[model samples]
Target chain A: MPHDHHDHDHPHSLLPSDPALRVKALETLLVRKGLVDPAALDAIIDTYETRIGPQNGARVVARAWADASFRARLLGDATAVISEMGYYGRQGEHIVAVENTDSTHNIVVCTLCSCYPWPLLGIPPAWYKSDAYRARVVREPRQVLAEFGLVLPEGQTVRVWDSTAEIRYLVLPQRPAGTDDLTEEALAALVTRDSMIGTGLARAPE
Target chain B: MKEPVFLEPWHAQVFALTVHLSDTGVVSWPDWAATLGAVLAEHGLDRQLDGGEDYFLAWVAALERLLAARGLAGAADLDDLKSAWTEAYLHTPHGQPVRLAGG
Candidate 1:
C-alpha cells in the first residue's frame, strides 16, 4: 500500500470510551467465578505507581544537579542507578537519561503505547499522551519543542528519543546557572514537568 | 465456546478513574498506569490470572483496589461514582445511562 498523505482516520481508538464498568463486570464474572484472585491484581498495581513516580525522577534529577558522582552513576546506568533510589524497572525495564547541553537539544516520546520511565518520573501528563504530541514529535521534534518555548541553536540537531518498552528515557536538563545557592527543592521546582519529558527545559532563577 | 472478554466492568471503571484523574492533571502518564497497577497488586489481585491480561488487567485491577483501599465508596457511593463516571468518563448523558425501569 502506498503511503497516502490523506490518511486522517487513525484506527487506534476503536472504543470511544473503554469504561471501567467493563472491568468491574469482568471481575465479577472472573474473580467471583474463580478465574482470578485478589493477589494477581495487587501485583500489577504495586509494581507500577508508588514504586516509581516523578518524585523518584525528581530525586534523581536533583541528585544529578547537586552530586557529580551520583550523576555519573545515573548517566552510566539509568535503570540500576534509579533502582538504587528504590524504584526502577517496574513498568519498562530499560532506562536512559540524556543530558541536555547548551549547544545541543533532546526530546522524548513514545510512538508506541506510551513507554515512559515511570520509576524515575511520575505518571505522564495528558498533553504528553495526546496524538498531537505523539504524531508531531518524531517528525518535527525541533518545531514541537519550539512550540513548548524551547529553541535550540541552528547547529544543534534536536535528538528525539522514541521511548520503547525495552528502553525508557528521561531528560537530564542542563542545570540552570545563577542558582548556585539554591537548594535542591528549589531546583526541582525549576524542573518543570515537561522538562523531564524532554519537550521543555528548566527555567533560570526568578 | 466464546473467548474470555479481555476486560471487565469494574476494570473499565478503574481505567476511567485513572484516565480522568490523568486527564484533569491529577496523575501523570508513567505513574498513572504503574501506580494503578501497583495499587491493584497491593490489594492482592495478581496471583489470580496466569498473566493473560497483563496490560489491561493491571491498571483495571489497580482502579478497583484504589477505590476499595481508599474506602472511597460504599454501594451507594459506587453507584454515584458510576453515574459521574458514565457522564464525565464515557461522555454519556446524565440520568440516561439506562432507561427508567418502567416509565
Candidate 2:
C-alpha cells in the first residue's frame, strides 16, 4: 500500500478533510478491486435510507396503538413480535419495548456508544451518535429533550434506558390525542423517528 | 465490551459497504473476518477499540490489504483514488457532493 504521507504541495486545509471523501475513496477502491459491486452497494444504501427506516418502526407503533394484543406482545417480547413482522437482524437481536404513558416518558441512550435498532429504525442520525448527546442525555434528559423541542408536562417523569450490545431499547411513544378516528396507516405516518427515540413527540394532526 | 457506534455518516457507509459486499458474494464472511482480525492484530488493536472513531480507518486499511493480497488492486490504485478524492473535495463547493473530476 502507499505510505501515509502529507502532501506538502497542497494545503491540508484544502484537501478532503471530511470522512465522506475517505469513504468514497475506499468504495471506489473496492469496486475497482472487483470485490464489491457498485449496484449492490447502491441497493443497500437505498434500502436503509428509504425502504427500511423509521417507517418500519412507525408501523409497529401504529399497530400497538390500533391493536391492544399486539401492543401487549410487543412490550412483553419485542424481538419476537418485531421479528414476526419481518424486522429482526444484526444490532437488533434483542429488543425491549418500553411504553410511554401519562405519568412517564421514555428515552434511550448508549453512554459508551450508539446502539440503535437498525432493523426497525435503520441507521441512527448523526446527532444520536454525538458525544454531547451521549454525555448529556443521561444527566439531564429533560433539558436535552427540550432542546429537541420536546418539552413534556411537569407531571411526566422521564426515564432513560442505557443500551448495550446484549439489549437494545425502543420507546413506544404514547398515541397522540384526537387520533382515535385515524386509520392505522395514518397513525403510522404521525410517528417520527425522534418520537420513537423519545427525543420528540408524535406529530400532531393538522 | 465497547458499544459499536458509528460516529459519522461515512462510518455507517463503510459498514454498509462491507455487509453488502459480503452478502453479494464478493467476499466470504470468514475471509472478511480473518482479514479484519489480521489488520487489527497488526496494529495491536482489539475489537473493543474498534468502536471508536478510528475503527473505520482500520476497516479501510484492512480492505486495501485484502484487495492487494487477492491481486485485485495494488497500492498504486488506492493512491490514485485517494488523490482523485482529494482533488474532488478541494474543487467542489462545501456542502455539495464531491465527485471524481474528469470521470
Candidate 3:
C-alpha cells in the first residue's frame, strides 16, 4: 500500500485514458443526445449508496437466526421468500441462500463476471470483483478465506457457490455463539458485508 | 484486510448510467446484460481484470455499443465528445473539474 513518489510522475500521464474523464465525456454526450437523464442517474446512484445494501441482507440473516420457520422458507424458496420481504429487483430476480453450519461453510463467487444480488448487497467490494478473487477463490477457497483473515478449522467442509447470470448466491453465516439473549436488531449488527459474501464470519458479540 | 474508502467515482457513474437507461425503458435489462457479457468476453480474454478501471472500461465500451446500435447516439458523436473532454482536461488547471466549452 505504499505510494511510490515516482508513480506520480509516470510517463503517458497526459494520455486521455483516465476513466473518470471518459465517463464524464460519455455522460455529457448522452445527456446532450437526450438519451440519458442526469437526475435519474443521480437518483439511481443515491439509491444504491443509501437505500439498498448489505443492511437488508443483515436483516434477513437476523430473521433467519431468530425464526426457524422463516429459515425453512428462505432455504426452500429464496426468490419468493426474499420477494416477500420486498427485496426483489434486477440482478436479484433469482437468489439461492446457502447456510453455514458447524460442519460446513459456504462461499459465493462469480468466476465469469460480477453478478450479484443488488437488492440485498450494494455494489460488490473491490475484492469480490477482482480477477484474482474470481479465479482463485473457486480453485482455493480456504486459502483465499485465510487471506481475508478467516481461518476455518480443519474437518469443516467448504462449499463454493459459483454464481451465474441466472442465479446469485448469498451466504448465511452461522450465528455467533452467546447471541441467544440478543434482540433481532442487535443480532443484525453483527453481520458484516464479507460475512454475507462468505469471506468472513459474523462478529462475535462483545 | 484493509478496505479503501472508495474506488474511482466514475465507475459508479457509468454503472448508474446503465441502470438508469434500463430502468427508464431505454433498453431492456436482458439486452444490456448480453451486450456487456459479450464485451467482457472480448476484452477480458486471458487477462486478470483488477475489477477496477479495466472492468468499468469494458462497461463503457459495451454501453457505447448499445447506444449506437439503438441509434441513440452515433459513434462519431462519442468520438467528438471524447476529444473535447480530452482537450478540456489538458487545458484545465490541476485539481479542477474538467468541463466542455458551453457545457
Rank candidates, TM-score, best first. 3, 2, 1
**DockQ score for candidate 3:** 0.45
The candidates, ranked best first by lDDT, are: 3, 2, 1
Number of the top candidate by TM-score?
A: 3
| Candidate 2 ranges beyond 4 A from true positions | A1-21, A28-37, B1-13, B21-103
Candidate 3 lDDT, A1-206, residue by residue in tens:
64556555543234345666667777897788787888988878778877888989999999999999999999998899999999987688899999999999999998767888888987788777777898899899999999999999998999999887788998999999999999999999999989999999999999
After superposition, which runs of candidate 3 have C-alpha atoms over 4 Å from their true positions? A1-17, B1-6, B41-46, B87-103
Worst 10 residues of 2 chain A by lDDT: A8-17
lDDT of 1 by residue, B50-83 (tens): 2333445555555544445545333455555445
| Candidate number with the higher lDDT (1 or 3) | 3
TM-score winner, 1 or 2? 2
Task: Give the interface-residue alpha carbon RMSD of model 1.
Answer: 14.5
Q: Please list the residue runs of candidate 1 whose C-alpha ends up more than 4 Å from where it truly belongs after superposition.
A: A1-18, A33-52, B1-103
Model 1 chain A lowest lDDT segment of ten: A10-19
